[model samples]
Structure formats: structure tokens, C-alpha cells
Target chain A: MAYPLPVANVRLKNLTKQFDGVTAVDGVDLDVADREFMILLGPSGCGKSTLLRMIAGLEDPTEGEVYIGETMVNDVLPKDRDVAMVFQSYALYPHKTVQANIEFPLKVRKVDKVERAKSALAAAESLGLGEYMSRKPGALSGGQRQRVALARAIVRKPAVFCMDEPLSNLDAKLRGETRAELIALHQRLESTFIYVTHDQVEAMTMGNRIAVMSRGKIEQVGTPQDVYDRPASVFIAQFVGTPPMNILPAGSIETGKHLVGVRPEHVHISPEGSLAMTVTLVEQLGHELLVTGRVGERRVVVRQPAHSVVPEIGAEVRIVADAADLHRFDPVTELRIDI
Target chain B: MAIDQIRGGRKIGRYVLLVVMAAIVLFPIYVMVIGALKPGNKVLVNPLLPSNVTFSTITRAWRSGHLARALVNSSIVALVVTTAQVITSVMAAYAFVFLKFPGRTVVFVLFLATLLVPLEATLTVNRRTMQSLGWLNSYKGLTVPFLATAFGIFMIRQVFLTIPKEMREAASMDGLGHIGFLREVAVPLSRPTIGALALFAFLTSWNQYLWPVLITTNSDYNTVQTGIAALQRASLSQPNLVIAGTVIIALPIFVVLISFQRQLVRGLTAGAVKG
Candidate 1:
């Protein structure tokens, strides 16, 4: 690898956090490019939040190093880290009005009233919270409260914005709305943003790059398409999609050299195919049809485009995927086999 | 709406239960007010309401018994005690919850373990410790021993625990020192619980009778609570005057109770929930 001229926003080298005797975050390395929207995507206990907190300097790394720009911030207190975080619960200062909450960082840095309000107003307006700047978090809707939280984080024009499931508290529709707002906000600010969520949909939609974490280590780090199209391992392939990527013990050990993977969209009714399967259940989503069934003892799922003539649940249909679409993994290692 | 629609004998039973509970709650308080207002001879009647409830006995009690002075002393002491106690508890709670240091958990466990070893059982050694400090008969004597209160620390610490680690991180990223973050973010987010704790501390300090009586011997140095008990002993036979002073002594607390009534309930429930 050659050096890129762009300075990395935050670089983690083997960052780790251990609690008591348990390793909560194992050796993990990551680079968040300047102005990039990177999501630390993983299930709970995967150490994603721990990584974000370490970057914010809330948690000290038990091992390894964290860099904000060129400085190693191993011992820096969170307040001096020049980062801002928005929590899953919004975690707004409920007693303070939106304006006061946004102005808090400035106040702590001893920025005067006039400048604090001006910057707070800009951040608040950027998040479409201009109309409700005087309201308390308790008085605002969940989405509004989340925006206020985002506003508070960006008001400082910080070098990094760390968000831990900031949209998790909202209702489903509101989650979608606030997520879009977050992306737009990221673009306009152009500061490094590291978001954490267990939801892959959020990771897929928002992150310019996504770091897939599992059990305290990075499973894969790439663009949404990169991780989705070429998952580095079985855990990621299964973890990154809805209805999860189905796994089957291969038809034969030799065939396992070129393993099988079919995206629900690619799993289609084929009049001619090699494998035999029995249909067990059918799911009709408005836009697509999913056929779940068994090939021997192993379960397989096939998803097809909506409004197309799809097979019935009791119908034993032949299905296949293009050779390029079929992913292969070493039978023993489970690491992907590049063609 | 479901409850309203729930009609019949069960509903009647609920109404009766509600009335009984309300009466149970109000009766003792009603009796106390009547006892305070009744003329000395009429006090034995235990009237439901005050008769001849003129302000004279209150005025007489307020002046002759030195109730006014006692009231002032309790106000000042309670105000000082509650502020010191809450601030200390919040700081202690913050340190225990957020900061990591060598022996930190052991120290927190030791502090919490203080609650198990009853303060009543430790009074002898505690009193000796105070005397050695030459703090007897002083506010330090009264307030110092009560600082780092087990309950205050427990309540504030419980509230501090639920504040997600993210807010603290956010505060720090904002370049806030620990104290700054506590004041600006953690404290504000935990305001309802803190509100409740402040009220609880004030009430506990104001209502404290045994500690203040043991520490302050002189009448003028007395807290209203301790002073009222002294006034009773000095004039054992004067029930009406004593009751009058009691009512006066109870007034400020009543005002605080009414004003911060919401927080008292919230504070208590928050503590209960956290525990």
C-alpha cells in the first residue's frame, strides 16, 4: 500500500478494550477517512460501541493505539478529544432547551454567547431544527430530539462525530427519516463520521464505508456493495443481509471448491438445474417473492422479483444462479475463494 | 376509558377502597392540625378540625418559646447541610460511576457497605471522632459527620448509573472537564432524579432530630427540631404552646413539600426503581 495524501480522520491500530478478565474488544484495526461516513456494523457485544467510545476517549484502550489526526490519544480525557457523540437514546440535556444543549460545548470551551448561538443556530438549521430551537428535548418529537442531538454534536465543527445508534429510539418510519437526515448532514459537514448500529439496513444505506464487526474483531471493511457482493467470510455473508444468506453443506466436497451463494433476488425458478430441492414455505413480499425450502437436511431460500410468475409453495421447482454469482469458500476455512 | 366502562359491584368496591385509603392518609394529619390549634383544655377532645383556631397561640408560641430563632437556625442548617450533602454525593457518585482508579471499585463497595453497618451502631465511635476534631457545638460538628451520607451517595450513584456512557463521552468530546461535564450534561440529563434527591436531602436534614439534639446543647444554637423538643422538656405541662410551636416548626417543610411535591414523588420512585 502506498501513502495517500489525505490525512486519515481517525486511525485505530489494534485497539482493544478488556473488562475484568473478558476481552470485550479484541485486537481491531480501522481507518476512517476524512469526511467519510463510516459505520461500525455488528451485533450487540461485538465491541462496536466500545470502539466508538474509545475514539471519543470515554474508554481507555487496554491495548493498542488510537489516533485523531497525527496525535496518539491513548491517555487523553474524552473532553479534550475534539470529538462529538450522539447516543442511541439521543441523550439530550433534557433540562436545557435545544439552544442551550447545542451551546454547551462552546460554553465549556469558553466560547462567548454570541458565537455559541451563531454556530448552534447553523447546526440546528442544518438538521432542520430551526423552528424548534427553543424547545426542550422532552417537548420535541423523537425525530426532532435526534436532530437536536445531531445539531449539538456538529455545532463545535468537530473533527469527528461519533454516533451510537442515534436513530434506535425512534419509531420505524422516523428511523428511516432521521437516517436520511444523518447522511445529508454528514455530506454538508464533511467531517469524519463513525456510526454504530446492529441493523445492517442502516449500515448498507448510510455508510460510505462499513466495517463489519463480530465478536470483537473486524470481519470485513468495505463499501456497502463491496461487503454485500464479496463478503470476506461466512459470518459476514450471513450477517449482512435480511433473511440472511442461506448456507448449505455443499452437494459434494469437490463442488465445495466453488461454493454456492444466491441472493434472494438472484434465486429464481430455473426450468433446468443440477440440484434437487423440496419447497416448505412461501413468502410473498409486495416487491418480491421468497421461496424457503429444504435441499436434503439443509434449508435453502430463493427470492424472486415481484409480480413475476413464481412457483407455488407445494411446487418443487428447479432453481439456479449464474456462475459468477455463486460464491466459493474453502470448505475448512470458510474464507472466500477468489475466482 | 376502560376503567370507566368497568361498571358494577367491583367498581363500587374500588370507590370504597379509594375513600378508605384517602381517609387513612388524611386523618392523622387532620388530628395534628386540630391538636395544634385547640385551646389547652380542648386538646383532649381530638376534634376533627380546629375550634377557636385563632392565630394567638401560634403568635405566642412563635415569640415566647424562641420558636422563631429555632426556625431560623434549622433553615440555615438544613440549607447548608442539604447543599453540602447533595453536592458531595453527586461528586462522589460521579467519581464512583465514571472515573477509574486503583482500588476504585473496592472503595465504592466499602462506601456502600457502610449502609449495612447501621449508623446507630457506630454512633459511639463517630461521636468520639467528631469530639477529637474539636467540632462539638459547631455547624461542622452538626454537618460534617452527616456528609458523605450513605443514602445520598446511594441515590445519586444509582441515577448516575443509568446515564448511558455516551453522554459522558459527548461531554468530554466537547472538551468539558469532569466537573464541567457533570454540571453541563450528566447533571442536567439526570435533573429529575437529582431534583428528587435534593428535596430528599433537604427533608432528611430538616427533619433530623436525634443528631442535632445530641450535638447542640445551647438553646440558641438549636435546630428548630431539637429546639422544639427542648422547649417541650422546659415546659412539660404546656401542651397547647408546644403544639403551636410544632405547627410553626412544621410550616417551612410544608411549604417545601407543597412546592417540590412532584420531585419528592419522582425522587422517591426513581430511587426505588434504580435499587
Candidate 2:
């Protein structure tokens, strides 16, 4: 049966959360479109998870409102909000088999036994967990356990699915595999997915729109390419890249009263270049080479193609980045400056 | 081969030590049984032997000591106390661990402070209170005083705390309210600890002697412990009869301990998380 699952639009109106005088989620406003895959990306302690929890009604906002699907859910209980959550630890009942775990939400809603069994079996089969229907969560591996958690959330056909680092416990290879599977599931079900993760790669790959947060506030919200190509602030530029963007002091660049940022891939090792550096280390991966060097007082890295000539560790090199590729930020405010 | 012989010798030594310890622990029970089986005239003679195994003294003890009524009274009181204690303990423990309220710590500490006051220290006052309430020689007097215990609260609270915070949050999101979560998740997860607490309350109430003697003057409300004491006083010349009463009182405890051994172990190690 092709279920017409209800999709929800989520809105946060200046939501704030404080724990013992420390603001975990400060006056943050966001809107998630119906059936959209929205990712909240940040480092640990940046309040992304707290923001999602507030939407789920697991945490009460200290100073604002949360609306889910046109209804203000601030005072509503989590279950009444018609939202499902996939926790970081999976949080599967240790005593329950996979089938029972999937059927738990349905059972709580007082669904009949035959209907519960049918829905649980369908969810499990879709997650490819049919063989593990009789196994306890402890008996399953981390990846399989996470699938059971996913099946449990979907069995009730919730409007919004809030996931808190659901793939963090898996190894790298499995995380990549699960990431694709989640995208496929989201597309098929067409339900709103609000995912939180500290890993920028996961955010860039999976989120239709990524909201980068830091210290209880949203730094920027945009499409993945928008965030990568034109970061709103130095923090976004530095936080969202692998071997993060090279930040140089204002004194080193001609950009007045502003710091210069260039991605590792944007910085080139050319004979006719502006910046001079001494190569210190070379990380040769199969597809790319990460070249680390010192540019005057600052440390810089360049991502070169694997076919490029490897530079000696102590060699002096000149690096250049196109003006279009450079991001200038006000040194004092740390906000981006359009030159 | 030499190493194997030494390992075998060590195993034998371990068995020998275990046998010695078991004998030491069981010696008193063995003596009580031997004494109970002997005729009153033969009780003091060769008390350790199995000779003259007459059960007339046991029958007399059961009849004259009013042990049958005493057993019924003790069972009712202990069962009531155990069930009430489990319910109160689980509810109180859940509130302490999960629910947030003002003065929570102060209230918890005050509750814990009750544990420091020995039950013996309050027995007299409790007996007097029961007398004033006109509940003396009644089941209410025996059971109400022990319907809840601070130790039970502390134990079940610790077990509840071991359940991760995420589980509670997940349950809430899964449409399970506080009472639903308690019934479906919290209580089931803590079955072992609850079982242990129930057994503890039952055993303590069953073995109560001082309070029963203080509040229960009528032999109809006499529990097993106090009934055994009365049997001792009445049969000073017939020691075998007292022995027979003691044996009967101790049998139920052994049966309970053996039957609930697994739950007892689990409850004792309640906070140890299993994968």
C-alpha cells in the first residue's frame, strides 16, 4: 500500500533554551518546508541537537514558540505532536525483539494486534530487517540496530522525523551506506526529516538545506552549494570545509580591514603567485594530495590532484588563489565582507 | 603430567574448604532438626544423632503453640506489606529520578535520613501509636507500620536511574505517558529489583518478633516469630517442642531464598548495565 503519510512544516520563532543560566539554544528562528530534508550542522555543544529536541517537544523552549504543521506545539506532549525521533544511541528497548520494537508505537496508540503485526512486518521488510524480526537489539550489530530504530519511527507514519546523529555510532563505511538508504527512504515516504549531526560531510551530502550553528545560534542557512561556495561568515568558511579554509591576517592581504579566506582546493602551487610558503608535509591520498606549508606566520594547506608532482617537505613554493575564489571577512566582526 | 597432578590437588583442596564452610553454616540447622525429631526425654541426649525420630513433638507444637494460626497471620501481614512496599517504592523512586520539582533534593535527603533511624529505636513509639489508634492485635497494626521503607525506595531509585535518559524521551515520543512508561518500561525493566525488594519486605516482616510481642497480646494475632517465643516460654520443660516450632519458621525463608535466587542476584547488582 502506498501510504499518504502526512508531511509537516516546522517553524521556530525565536526559540531559546537555557540550562542553569547557560543558553544551550539561544533565540533561534528557522523554517523547515514540508517533506524537506533539513540538516542542523554544528560542532559539539553548539545546540543543534537542542534545537531539534525543542521541535520534538522533548525540551521546552525557554522563550519562544515551535509550530509543527500549522499547529503551535509548545504546550503539546511529544506523542500528541505526531513526530517521531531517532536517537543517537538508537534507544531500542533492550528486552524487545525487532518486531516488538517496531510495533511499540502502534501498540501505544491502541492499534489492533493484526494491524500492528502487519504494519511492523511491512516496516521491517522495507528496512531489510525481516530476518532479524525475532532478534533482540543487543544481538544485532550497530547498523542493524539503527535500521530497527528507523523502522520503529516509520511504523507510526509520523508527520516529522527528527533524528539526532542516528548514524554516529556506526563505522565510516556503514555510515555512508546508511546515509544513502536514509535519502531513498525520505524520498519514498516524502515526510519532513530534521537531522542533526556534527559531521559536515553528512550535512553537505544529505541536507537539501543546511543550517550551520555555533554557540546557540544559527550561523547560516542555505543549500549545500550555497554554504560551500559563499559562506556568510569566517566561522562558516572555516567550519564547513575539509582541512578548513586557510585564514590569513589582514596585514598579509591587500583587502583593507578584512581577513582573507581561500579553500584548500582553491589555493594553487604556481611559479607566478602572490603568497610565498615553505612546504612542511604532504598527505598523499589515492584521489588527492593535501600539501601543508607555512605562509609567513600562518599555516596553509593546498589540495592538489593526485597526478600533480609531489613537492619536497622543505621546498619553498609560491601559492596563488583567484580573486573570485577569495572570501574576505571583517577581522573584528568575523562576518564576511563583500569587496 | 606433574602440573596436572598439582591442579587436581588444588581442586581437591578447594572442595575440602567448601565442604568445611558449608558444614559450619548448616551446623545449627542440623542440630535444630535433630533435636526436633527426638522424643522430649531424649532431646538432650545425643542431640546430634538421628535416633528416636518421633514427630509427636512437632504435632504438639503445631497444635498447642497455635502455630497454624500464627502462620496464617504472618503470611497475611508479610504479603500485604510486601505488595504495598513494592508499589510505594516504585512510584516514589520514579518521581525522585524522573520528575522535577522544587526542594527535590531536600525531600529526598529527608527521606534518606529516615533510614538512619534504626527500626528498633522506633518500635516502642510505633507500638504506642498503634495502641492509641485502637489498632493493636489487628492486621493493620502489624502491616501498616512496614508498608513502605526507605531502603526499598533507594534500591528501586538506583535501578531506575540506570535506565538511560534517552529511553524515557523515546517513550514519551512514542505516545507513552508517565504512567504508561512506568507500567510498560520502568516496571518491567526493574522486575528483578522489585522482586528482591518484595522478598526482603516479606522476610523482614515474617521474622518480626519485638513489635509483634509489643502490639499483639492475643494469641490469635501472634505471628510466627512471637508465636515461637510463646512456645519457648510455655514448653520450658519440653525443649523438643520449641525446636519443632523453630524448624517450621525457618523452612519458608529457605524456600523463598532458593526460588528467587536469580532475581535476588540481579537486584543486588541492579545498577550494573547489561548490553
Quantify all predictions' global Cα lDDT against the true fold: 0.80, 0.93
Off by over 4 Å in 1: A1-8, A242-258, B1-69, B102-143, B188-248, B251-259, B271-275
True contacts kept of each: 0.91, 0.85
Chain A only TM-scores, each candidate in turn: 0.94, 0.98
TM-score, chain A only, candidate 1, equals 0.94
Over A1-339, each residue of candidate 1 has an lDDT whose tens digit, in order, gives 111122248999998899997888899999888889999999999999999988987788999999999989888877667787888877677778899988888888889899889888877887778888888888998888888887787777678888998888899999898888778777666678899999999999999999999889998999999999999887888899888776656663126444555566666667786566788887888987788887777678888777767666667777676666777766677778787
Worst 10 residues of 2 chain B by lDDT: B266-275
Model 2: runs farther than 4 Å from truth? A251-255, B1-12
TM-score of each: 0.84, 0.97
Q: List the residue pairs that clash in candidate 1.
A: A78-B172, A79-B172, A79-B175, A259-A328
lDDT of 2 by residue, A48-147 (tens): 9999999999999999999998899999999999999999999988888899999999999999999999999999999899999999998999999999
Q: List each candidate's DockQ score.
A: 0.60, 0.83
Write candidate 1's Cα lDDT for B1-275 as tens digits: 66666766688899999999999998877777777777777777746766776667677777777887888888878888888888888999999898978998899888888889876797778777878887778788878777668678878888888877766666667776787878876687677777877787788888888777766777777888887887788767878778888888888899998999987787767745642
